[model samples]
Target chain A: MSTIALPHQERGASFWRLVELVGCYVLGLLWIMPLLYAVWMAIHPPEYEVRFDLFAPLTLDNFIAAWSAAPFARYFFNTFVLISVILVAQFVICTLAAYAFARYEFKGKTVIFMLILLQLMVMPEVLLVENYRTMVRLGLVDTVLAMGLPYMASAFGIFLLRQAFLTVPKELDDAARVEGAGSVGVLLRVYVPLARPVYVAYGLVSVSYHWNNLLWPLVITNSVSTRPLTVGLQVFASPDQGVQWSIISAAALMTSAPLLIAFLLFQRQFVQSFMRAGIK
Target chain B: MSKLSRLQSQATPWLLLLPAAVLLATFTHIPAVTTFINSFYTTPRGARPARFVGVEQYQSMLADPVFLAALKNNAIYALGTVPLAIGLSLLMAIIVNSSIRGRALLRMSFFLPTVLPMIAVANIWLFFYTPGYGLFDQILANFGFSSTNWLGSPNTALPSLMLLGIWKEAGFFMIFYLAALQQISPSLAEAAALEGASRWYYFRRIVFPLLMPTTLFVLVNALINSFRLIDHVIVMTRGGPDNASTLLLYYIYNTAFRFWDTAYASALTMVLLAALAAFSFIQFGILDRKVHYK
Candidate 1:
């Protein structure tokens, strides 16, 4: 920290600073170029896809074509249902488990907690073969339930909620208990309300994750009615469809629009939520 | 407390933990054990119900060329992507955290890729990598280089995917770095400035050490993600050009679903589980010593 900055170093620093700023912007532009290009190609006619012209007429025919080409509405509905089921279940299940871990001392608590945390490593994604077998035995193949079941008890969610619940002061719990609130009542009145921000953070992360998740859903769902947007997009853009770049780009954008729009609208919260989820 | 209350207290935590326990057991724990157990058996075609093959399946997996290739490809993928993504994310975090113009917009651009589905990002990059008229070709044409088959050729296939991996992941990691950066006191920078210390000198000696925990955290995630990368492969290449881009998990998917070789896929999954277990070891073993838990 005490290295001497010579007289000429000050002048060089400002020059390098400008270069660094410009470099940052340039990299940012490079980072977003693919998405920008997708938007450009999607909005314009097919002929203008490879040829970029500022004066090109923009139309939504690609979107219209994409919409009519597939059962995207049904796919959207399945995705919505899938994510909702997963999110709600995760919230309920993880909250209960997290609460137990945060507030209670019990037998085999450490071992059980460690076993639960193992999910973070050997995720369902890696155990697809056996999980698929499990689904087959359960008679849950091709259903939205199969897609959401494997992910319901999210170790990540439990961990995050536990961290949040631990930060809640014990006095609040005792006060609620003295006021004649039962354990569940205390949890609902004190811990849940106070952990609202963590809930919001966890909810956003969970929704985004399941919404974007493809592999497991693709494996489990055999019908269009159960396929999420990601699987549907893969099927629509598959090589047998003959590489219609414009329509595919539009479909891609459409499939991602809800998340993209939400992210843009609440950029700060989204970023913070991701940050919160990632830390510890 | 009453006797009933004491009894309730003893039972409450287990009751609360029941749902998650059942679900986790059903999905994660049971499946993991079953995957390992099934790896030692045959695929059980028709009436021949899966007879125990012992280490026969393991030996065949050792002999399988594609499995070895996928293993090598995944190693290369993890090696290439993790360090690059971590470095680029740290750089992006630094740039965004500084007193720069349009920091919000810059931050948004970097983080926007993280929000989009990997499948969609692969779709966009698929177009970019298309030969003759793709985005890359158009730019390379300006410099008078002939258009090359990016994903079609075996030599460039995995590297091309790695490029996309870095692009999509850096921003996600950046948020973690940014969070860590904010926790750092500003007075450290101010004191360094007052001492006339060079910015690079301060960053190298002071800031880098402070960011070690975040780096380790991001490193573990990036490594895990590298193995989990099958979406883009499914989207773009499908491990094409003579299985050049075939990652371990992608191969596992292909084996289990496409080839209907569930037994071999279980063996492959065991390999992946082993890799993850190694990372878990690193997380608990090294992370405990290095990461300061404030």
Candidate 2:
């Protein structure tokens, strides 16, 4: 249907529309100002770190200084391993549990599912004291495994995969069975493949989350070897070290560059995956 | 099916569920129960065994001024952040959802913070809030304003942290609102236009009502995040300047790890758990009703 309108109405609407566009642009610039500032500081010399000079000669010295200032290579390795372990474990454990919940009829299914769902509200982070004590008892404290263990079986992962699996037609299950595939085979060939999109979405969320996670790892790990980038950066930037804006900005950007670069390159997929994941 | 196959069928779900059940019970359920129990006992010293305190830790928590300050600060932080972030998020979503120029760039700018680590963001903001030569001070100096200790002062510390929280979260919440707005049919807007309803009136009467479920969902998330998003506090403030910016979770962290007062930390944790439980009840209640209505 055509929207026939008077000239006055059109003018009024266009005026408000112009106002909104300007407001959005201003807000957008404000929102991105911090990152822009980081970029400027990281690329500029120490004396020009805070100064907004259009013609300041940029140098790679900040990045070089930031790299040599700390054990950043070890920190990056630890973070990579931490997220990898957590994501792999989450995929395995959640897939099995979600497959069961989607396909099986078992005793106490409702009660068990309710119990599992309780983790949604009461995350392991909330039980830090007890979890730390448990880690101590198991002699797993100060280990990367300790950093990844508590989050390996994620409620959110299970819930998302369960939703994905439920949408897979039972006809496929029966067909796989008739083709001499067992239950595990059907899940491997059918359910897992069908849930690839959910896996990608969950993987991105979980990776970003565990990569950025600091508190638990900080509480549990005491040494440089096991420390992730977040905790390492915190220690590096602690006021005891004295403030050096250029190097600090460079260090911050270095720690966050992987995900930042990924987001920049695959901006559409990153946002669309989150939207498709239906995380709200 | 054969008897053996029937037996296998009965055991299959249990077997499939075993790994998840073990991990969840170990980390979530058992820790939760132990946290409650641990709160009732005194922390064991190096050479001494633990002893039952019988709610003394809770009593001490009631009297501890730091705990009280952290709790109050958390309340203020929540008050400052939740509504403002949600409102800004909704506004952003509406702006981006319209046929605006550079919508993709706008959405990306808003969503970039969601991908970056909070610890890193806090570091960037540390530079911004640094006195004298900081980014904020540099800009303020251009206008003939003096440098302010944004992170070091008691007055501005928590509010500075609140600003960080809002910047980080508004875009995340906007995604949900954008998703919800996309689901809304264009006919609603057309119909509202035909009725000569102003845009504000249309949004208030029609769009807002239609977005109730998303609003509720975002509210629950914001509530959880108010307690959970303490990473920046750890990095930027360390709950410093006489505990001005100390949040509930950060306080519990400090009490437990830094001070080695596990019992008192357990008590503080119980308070956090109770708040989460209350919000969870509200979330599930509203979510169930939303499902039923649908």
Candidate 3:
């Protein structure tokens, strides 16, 4: 109350509230303009495209055309494999590290943890040159495995899971140990079930990120077979040779549908997951 | 239970860390070392030696106009996106913080751009910018202005990319602010309101100061994304129209793969790494002083 500078006010809540309502409506339309536009283009044929006619005839021709035009099924499969591999690998390895960090006392734990944190700051994108060279040396370039391998050891995931694991009571750990549960048993039976939300949060973040990732896949993959949808969509859309905007939007829709559907289904969890992931 | 040996008993944490350590070492650490090594040598096509050129590549990379231009564009991109997005999100957070109607719907609208993939957003926006068949041009045509080349020109490419980026990222950052706003005590606002404080006055005085910590966090997050987030440019611009939109990461891609200048790319990598570390240090410094963590 003391900090309130009433006389210094330019715009108050009442002013800004109206501003926000107008803002919400205007900006909401702007924010969704691209999606709506894409949907419009995807549904309408060339004659009706961008006519702003309101009564333009719509059809599923774009989807069928886009599907027949590219190896979208294979692209979807590659993206699936790439996402699943990274997700599975991240969970298994990060959980182990997180469990130890959460429960046990160890020498140099902070230093080791700090070292892991270093990679989080210096992402693989920054160090792409050498990574490519290494991949070249190993002949792993253009492989879907190459796409997932770099992100397998996720420091952020470990940090998150560890934070979650620490919330569990030491008494719980003690009880599990006294019950003749080994470290593995305690981790699996006690630590994991409790930290399920963090797991779900991390898994969703990883899936969406990898699902939409383009640059890395673009660099590693060359051919259509090895390409994920993001890169595949790019190749289809890049050179304006013979590609139709309508069909491209359809491909875009197909590429984005799974995550969008997951998001629509689990909107609350998704937002919360992003919040958790961002904070950590 | 039979008691294990002291060595085995003390090995638990180490054992847990081992898997992550191995994978990180293999994937990240090893590749980082390799990128560093490759940066000192010239790995030309059909060349085996990759002659240890010392700092020659570094010197030349420093002199390269394209490299410098990319660095400048990247700086502008960061400057453009970071402050604007954070500020927008802060405003959105403030608005959403109030007992507004359709909170869920508002939040959902704010978050919708985020759910859509960057590539998809770009694709849609690209069409929006498409010369004759696009939305922006169609509007311009209605207004009796000639359609401008949106992404096709070198001058507008980077800024256009920034627009798309800010639109996509504001919601993600808004979520952070919403969370941070939730952390602020509503009683503080009520007390301000009781003191004849207007919403802006309360927000500017009471709320904004309390939100400094969140602002700092958002700034650092935005800065990191601005610097390292070049995935969009790769698909949208490809550092094209005379390398107009080539940020550091995008340039690193070009240097490594397109131009195959691995050594110079290494130096570029180190530069960004240094910038990130310095930015992080600054953030840590601010967080240390201001943030009252619970």
Return whichever of 1 and 2 wins on DockQ: 1
Interface RMSD of each: 3.3, 3.4, 3.8
DockQ of 3: 0.51
**lDDT string, candidate 2, A89-146, tens digits:** 9999999999999999988999999899889888888889899999999999999999
Residues B108-218 of candidate 1 have per-residue lDDT tens digits of 999988899999989989999989889999899999999999999999999999999999999999999999988877778778777887778888878888888888888
Worst 10 contiguous positions by lDDT, candidate 1 chain A: A1-10
The lDDT of each candidate is 0.90, 0.88, 0.80
Worst 10 residues of 3 chain B by lDDT: B91-100
lDDT of 3 by residue, B107-175 (tens): 777788887778877877777777766888898898898877877898888988999899889988898
**Tens digits of per-residue lDDT for model 2, B1-294:** 999999998999999999999999999998888889988999999989889989999998889999999999999999899999999999888877876679899998999998898999998998889898788888899899999999999999999999999999999989888888888777877888878886667777778887888888788889988998789998888998999999999999888888998988888999999988888888777564763212
Quick one: how many clashes does candidate 3 have?
2
TM-score of candidate 3 restricted to chain B? 0.92
Best by DockQ: 1
Q: Note the chain A TM-score of all models in turn.
A: 0.96, 0.95, 0.91
User: Which residue pairs collide, candidate 2?
Assistant: none
Residue ranges of candidate 1 with Cα displaced over 4 Å: A1-9, B1-3, B290-294
